[model samples]
Target: MIIGYVTNFNLNQLDFNIKLKIQSDKFISSNCRKQYVKYLLDFEFRKNFHCIGIPIIKDPPKDSFVIGHHFFNDQENRKIGSYIFSYCFEKRHYVNLPDFTFNTLLILSHPKSGMLHFKDRNKRILFIKPKPKYISLCTSREDICGPIFMKQKANIIKKIDIEVDDNCEIGDNCICKNKTLKESENDLKFIYFVPKNTN
Candidate 1:
C-alpha cells in the first residue's frame, strides 16, 4: 500500500519527492535489471533519491528482512505490486517486551474506564478499519489525531496476574528463523489468513 502510494505520489500527481528504502537479508535475484549483492540499490525520483540496502543480508539477525520475490522492471506500472512484509521498525513504538519479539503492536489501555485492562484487542490493534473518508485507513475509532481520547500510552511497572498470552504464528511467506513465540496472542485462532474470535 505504501509503496504503491509512494510511486503514484512521486511521479504523476504530486510535485515534491518521496524516497523509500527497503533493507533485506536474502540476495535479491535479478536477471536483466541487475540486483547488486552486498551493495546499495539506488532509485531516482525528481531531485530526490531512493535507496535499498543489504543490512540484514550481511549479518542475518533475528526478525530481520528477507527477499520475497524477484525484481520486475515495470516502467509504466512502477511500484504497483503486493508488498508482504514480515517485520517493520518504529523507534517510538518500541516496548521492552521480554518475551514478545516482533514489530507490530503497542499495548494501550482504555481511557474512560481507568482500569488497567485493555479493550477489544482485535479492533484497536489487529485490523485496520477506515472511516467515511478513505484517507485514514489505519486510523482507529479510539484515535483522534495523536491525542486519542479513548486510548493512552502506559508502561507496565508491575504486572499483576496478567498471564501473557503466547499464541504466535509464522506469516504465509515467512523466511526469518528467529521469530519469537511471544508475538502471538491468546485469542488468535485463524482459519487460513483470516482471524477468528470464537474463543
Candidate 2:
C-alpha cells in the first residue's frame, strides 16, 4: 500500500511558536490521521511494529507532540526528500515543535539553499542551516536517474524495464523525421550495490 503524508504543524526549526500550531485540533484531525497511514508502503511493519519508548530531549516544549511512522521499500530506496519537512514534522512526528498562530505552512513549504557551519571549542559543533534564498528546480542527479532499488549490504538488483520510443522531440529545430525507422528505441537494465544497514 503506497502511503503519503503531510505534517499537521510546522516541524522545521525548533521554536516555541511552532509548537503551538502542532498541538492545534486542526492539525490532528481524524481525516488527516487516516490519510497519514494510507501512504505506508510497508505492510509487515505496519502490522507487527511496536514503539519501544519515547526519549525526553532537553528543552522540550510543554505542549509539544511527537509521532512516529514507518515505510517499506523492498525494491529500491525511492528519493523521499520531497517529504522531508512534512514527514519530519508531521508524518513521523519524529521531531518536537511548538504551536503558533502564524501560518507555519508558508515558512515550512518555502524552498531554501543547503549550507553548513561549524562552531565549537573542539570544532565538534556543526551548524547546518538552510539558506534564506530559494532555487526553482534544485533537484539532484539521482532524481534525474529516477528511483533506484533499495538493497541490503549485498542484495541482488531487480530488472527494471526502460523503454524509449519515437515520440522523442529533439529541439526547436529538430530534423530526424526522414528516417524510415521513424525513431530509435531501446531498453537498459542494470544493477548496483547497497550497504547492509541502509534500511
- Which runs in model 2 stand beyond 4 Å of their true positions? 1-28, 35-199
List ranges where model 1 is wrong by over 4 Å: 1-12, 27-180, 185-199
> Which residue pairs show collisions in model 1?
25-57, 167-184
Q: Residue-wise lDDT of candidate 2 within 149-182, one digit each (tens)?
A: 2121222222222222345443322222223211
lDDT of 1: 0.21
Using lDDT as the measure, which candidate wins?
Answer: 2
TM-score of each: 0.16, 0.16
Compose the digit string of candidate 1's lDDT tens values, residues 1-199.
3433343343343323332234322333232122111121232211111111112233443552232111112233332111112222322111111211111111122111111112243333322222111000111111111111121222111111212213324333222322331222222111101112112
lDDT for residue 117 in candidate 1, whole number 0-100 = 14
